[model samples]
Target: MFKLRGRLEKHGEIFEIGQSVKSPILAVLPSLATKFYSNVPTPYEIVDAQEDRKTYQGTIDNVNRQVSEGKQGRIFAVVHVAGKQFKITEGDVFVIEGYWPPDAGDRISLDKVLLVGASDFTLIGRPLVQKGLVRVEATVIEKTLSHTKTHFRKKRRKQYMRINFYRIPQTMLRVNRIEIVGEVNHPPDVTGLETRIF
Candidate 1:
């Protein structure tokens, strides 16, 4: 004789099966199937949400304190300017090639910051950092033309030759300072230009 032993559920109540059968069965049937299955989390996989939040808050506080005290050390930033990106620090001079409209002695603030770092922490942007977070100030020190380059082409059999020389305009920029002007994780309020003229 064979007996089937398993648990059955009906009307939110569980009832045991094969209890009254006196004959011994060669094999026992497993419990009823479940709709879904999930693995139990191990010790290493379990995370305490409160503790994680506390640690994150502590790190933000530390960075804020460092910024407040001005002890964060020399900061550096990667800024996008005039279709190019430049990794700049305070007092660094760099050149931009092309026709840029900014004239010499013009002070400009680079708004398209990609990354900013200090001695302790770094902030990276997805496409760009939050506006007003990192301020990179620079001045147009000089505007001049790059060294001339010759473009020559010749066809020996056809007796055709062409020679051209040209120079590209360049703008020299001196980074005045790079600083964190806004609190970490805090973004400025959004405003629209509804009432202003172009």
Candidate 2:
């Protein structure tokens, strides 16, 4: 057993050392920021956020105008799928290279949204946007194999030669639509408060 030179002093020193160790680890892990800072914007984030401390709702009048006018053809979202990201809009068709999980003709909801942009505003996620906030509904149009690719290798001054053929499975998706359901700052009520407004 070690002798304590006053319990408070020893505990305080240990606590300080523990905090010093955790500070570095916390800094390295971005996921811990929300717990430590309540998701407060960093200096770099503040600068990136239009160099203003205020949220992207730059003007109340502008928001009102956009609300009144309604969202049009400018709606689009950056969706993450099968280790790749694609910037997609409604009615746009894009092919997902390599093996994909969904079946052909299956309607799947893309929840890993990196960013959602409109004509007036942009909502960017830290790593991924919150699920259900920006809904990206897509349909698996077709699942097929890519064009035949031949891998050829030859050694100079040697008789070693090898050829390999591959046809990667590809998934074609049609973005059904992107719907920004609610405000970023506030979550819509269960009773359908958003429906009441324009």
Q: Compared with the true structure, what per-residue lDDT tens digits does model 2 show for residues 60-159?
A: 3455456446743468899888888999999999999987789998999898999987777777888877555788999999999999999999998899
Per-model tally of clashing residue pairs: 0, 0
Q: For residues 20-91, write the lDDT of model 1, one tens digit per residue.
A: 433342133222222233365655767799999999999989988899899999999998988989999999
Q: What are the candidates' C-alpha RMSDs?
A: 13.1, 14.2
Against the unseen true structure, what C-alpha lDDT does each candidate score?
Answer: 0.83, 0.73
Q: Which stretches of candidate 2 lie over 4 Å from their true place?
A: 1-69, 187-198
What lDDT, from 0 to 1, does candidate 1 have? 0.83
**Candidate 1 local Cα displacement, residue 10, angstroms:** 63
Q: Which candidate is the best by TM-score?
A: 1
Q: Which pairs of residues collide in candidate 1?
A: none
How many Å off is the CA of 67 in candidate 2? 4.8
